[model samples]
Target: MINVNQITHHFVLGKKGNKTIVPVLKNISFQVNQGEIVTIVGRSGSGKSTLLNLISGFIHPTEGEIIIQDKKVSEFNETEFADFRLQHMGFIFQNFQLIPSMTAFQNIELPLILKGMSENARRKTTADMLKKVGLEDFGEHYPSELSGGQQQRVSIARALVLEPPLILADEPTGSLDSETEQDLLQFIRELNRDLGVTFLIITHDDEVARIGDRTIALADGKIVESGVFA
Candidate 1:
C-alpha cells in the first residue's frame, strides 16, 4: 500500500540566480490499499502529474512524506530507492517509454534482466507476461510497429512482469481511440480482478475514473474532493 501525508511540491522560477517558488502541490494526503484501483482525476496543469511524481520520489516534496509499505520514501538513499522501485513499483508512463529497437518481449524483460535473472528465466517470464497481456504473438515486434493500444498492452505487460505490488499509470490510455481505450481498460480491470495488482492511475477521463474504486480530485495543487463510488 501507499500513503501520502500533507505533501507539497514547489518549483523555483527566476532569472539571474533569483528564484520565486511556484507551488505545484499543496497538502495532498491519501492512501491506496493493496488490491485497489485509485484514480487521481483532473485537467491539465491541475497538479495530478506532479502528485504522481511526488509519490514516485522522482521529485521530493517540499513538505510531508510518502510511505510505501512501512518505509518513508523521503528517507531512503538513492541506492535504496532504486532497489525499491525495481522491486515494488511498476510505472506505465503517459508516454510509452519503450525503446524503438527493442522487441516487445525484450522491453518487458529489461527489469528482470537488470536484476540478473538468468537468460532462461528471463525468456520464460517474458513469454508468460506477453501471454498474460495477450501480446504473445507480437513478442518479436518493435514499438514502432505496434498500434497505440498494442504498445500500451506491451507497457502493461512490462509493468506486470515483475509482479510488483504497486503500479503507477499516468494517462495510460491518453492517445488511443475509444475502442482501444476500452480494450486497455478491460485488461486493467482483469488484472485488478485476478492478479490483485494495486494501481494508482492519473487520468482526465471520467470513464476511466468510473472504473476506479475511489476517486481523488485535484485542483490547483490540492485535493478538492475524494470519495468512493457507491
Candidate 2:
C-alpha cells in the first residue's frame, strides 16, 4: 500500500546568510502492504515521526520517492498533496490535535464537509464514528471539556470518520494512563481487524510496537531491525 525508496531528508536552518543542513532520515526504504499494521519504534530523535510525515505527504523527502498504491506522491505539489491526503490518509497525532473551539461532532464532521458531502450524510457518518469510539454522549463537548482519553478518542474518531485507506498514528498513547493506553490499543486493533484499515504507527514503546503485524525499529534516522514479533 505504501513504498518509500532510499529517501533522505535534511532541513535548512537559520537565515540564508548562515545556513545549516540538519539531516533527519538517510537512505530509508520500506513497504507496507494493504490491511497490515506496521509499527515504527524509536527514541525521541530517531526520525520516526519524520518518516511518517514523509509517507503522508505532510513533508517531502530531500531525495528519493514515496509511493502510495501506484501514485508517486514525492512528485505532488502542495495542492495535490493536500488533496491526496484528504482522499487517502487519516492522521492521529499524539497531542490529539482537536480544535478547542469546535464540538467533538463538529471536529469530526469538518472533513466530510470539506469534501462536499451533504449535511445529512456528514451527520450520520460523524455520529457513527462517535459511537464507534465510545464518544456518543460527548458529541457536544469541546476538547477542553473532555478527559485525556476522551479527547484521544475524539481524535481517533475524527481521523476515521472519512474512511481513509490508511491511518498514520504518531505516539498515539503517549499521554494516557496504562489502562487507557491498553483500551486505545485494543480499539485500534479492532479497527484494523474489522475495518481493514492499514496502520503505520510511530511509538517509542516496545509493548506498543508488539501490537503491530510487524515492527520496525529505528535509530539515528535509520532502520536497525524490522521483523514480525515472536
Candidate 3:
C-alpha cells in the first residue's frame, strides 16, 4: 500500500551562510502491503514521527519518493496532496486533535461534510461510524466531556468515517493507560481484519509493537531492523 524508496529528510538550521543540515531520516526504504498492520518503532530523536509526517503528506520528502496505492504522492503539491489525503488517507494523532467545541457527532461528520456528502448521508455515515467505535451514546459529548479512551475512539471514528483505504496513526496509544492501550490495539486489529483497512502506525512502546504483523525499528534516523513481530 506504501513504498518509501530511498527517502531522506533533513532540517536546515541557522541562517543561509552559517546553516547546518541535521538529517532526520536517511535512505529509509520500506513497504506496507494492503490490509497489513505495519508498525514503526523508535526511541526519541529516531525520526519515526518525521517519517510518518512525510508519508502523510504534511511535509514533503527532501530526497526520495513515497508511492501510495501506486501514486507518487511525494511529488504532489499542497493542494493536490490535501485533496488526495481526504479521498485516500485517514489520520489518528496522539492528542486526538478534536475541536473542543464540537460534539463527537460533528467531529466525525466533518470529513464527510468536506467531501460534499449530503446532510442525510453524512448523518447516516457518521452515526454508523460512532456505533462501530462503540461511542454511539457519546455522540453528543464534546472532547472535554469524554475520557481519554472515549476521545481516542471518537478520533478513530472520525478517521474511519470516510472509509479511507489507509490510516496513518502517530503514537495512537501514547496517552492511554495500559488497559486502555491494549483495548485500542485490539480495536485496531479488529478494524484491520473486519474492514480490510491498512495501518501504518508509529509507536515507541514494545507492547504496541507486538500487535503489528510486522515491525520496523529505527535508530538515529536509520532502519536498524525490520521483520515480523514474532
Candidate 4:
C-alpha cells in the first residue's frame, strides 16, 4: 500500500542563529501492506514523526522516493500533492487539532464537505463513522465541550470518514489517562480489523506498539529493529 525507498532527511538543529544541517535519517526504507497496523516506536528526536511527514508530502527529502499505489508522490508539484493528500490521506495529530468553532459532526464532515460530496452522502458517512467510534450522540457538541478522549474519538472519526486507504496517527494516545488510552488504542485496532484501514502509527508507549501487526524501533533515526511482535 505504501513504499518508502532510500529516504534520508536532514534538518538544522539547535537555536535559529546556530542552526546546522545535521543528518537525522539515513537511507531508511520500509513498506506497509494493506489492512495491517505498523507501529513506529522510538525515543524522542528519533525522527519517527519525520518519516511520517515524508510520506505525507509535508516536506521533501534530499534523497529518497515515496510511492503510494505505484505513483511516486515525491515527484508531485505542490498543487498535485495537496490534491493527492486530500484524496488519499487522513492524519490524526497528537493534539486532537479540531476546529473549536465547529460541532463534532461538522468537524468530521469537513473533509468530505470540501471534497464536494453531497450533503446526504456526507451525513450518512459522518453519522456512520461517529457511531462506529461511539460518538453518535455527541455530534452537535463542540470540541471544547467534549472530554479529551471524546475529542480524540471525534478526531479519529474525521480521519476515517474519508475512507482513505492509509491513516497516519502521531502519538494518538499521548494525552489520555491509562484507561482512556487503552480504550483508544483498542478502538484503533478495531478499525484496522473491521475496515481494513492500513495504519502506520507513531508512538512511544509500549502498549501502543504492542498492538501492531509489526513493530519497528528507531534509535537515533535508524530502524534498529523491525519484526512481527503480535
User: How do all models score by TM-score?
Assistant: 0.96, 0.97, 0.98, 0.94
Itemize residue pairs with steric clashes in candidate 3.
Answer: none
lDDT of 4 by residue, 93-131 (tens): 899999999999999999998899999999999999899
Estimate, for each residue in 29-88, the C-alpha lDDT of model 3 and write its tens digit. 999999999999989999999999999999988999999999999999999999999999
Mind sharing the TM-score for model 3? 0.98
1-230, model 2: which lDDT tens digit per residue?
A: 99999999988999979999999999999999999999999889999989998888878899999999799999999999988888888989899999999999999998898889999989999999999998999999999999999999999998898899899999999888899999999999999999999999999877789899999888999999899854
Error of 1 at 193 (Å): 1.3
Q: What are the lDDT scores of the predictions, listed in order? A: 0.89, 0.92, 0.94, 0.90
Query: Model 4 off-target regions past 4 Å?
Result: 13-19
How many Å off is the CA of 226 in candidate 2? 0.6
Worst 10 residues of 1 by lDDT: 221-230
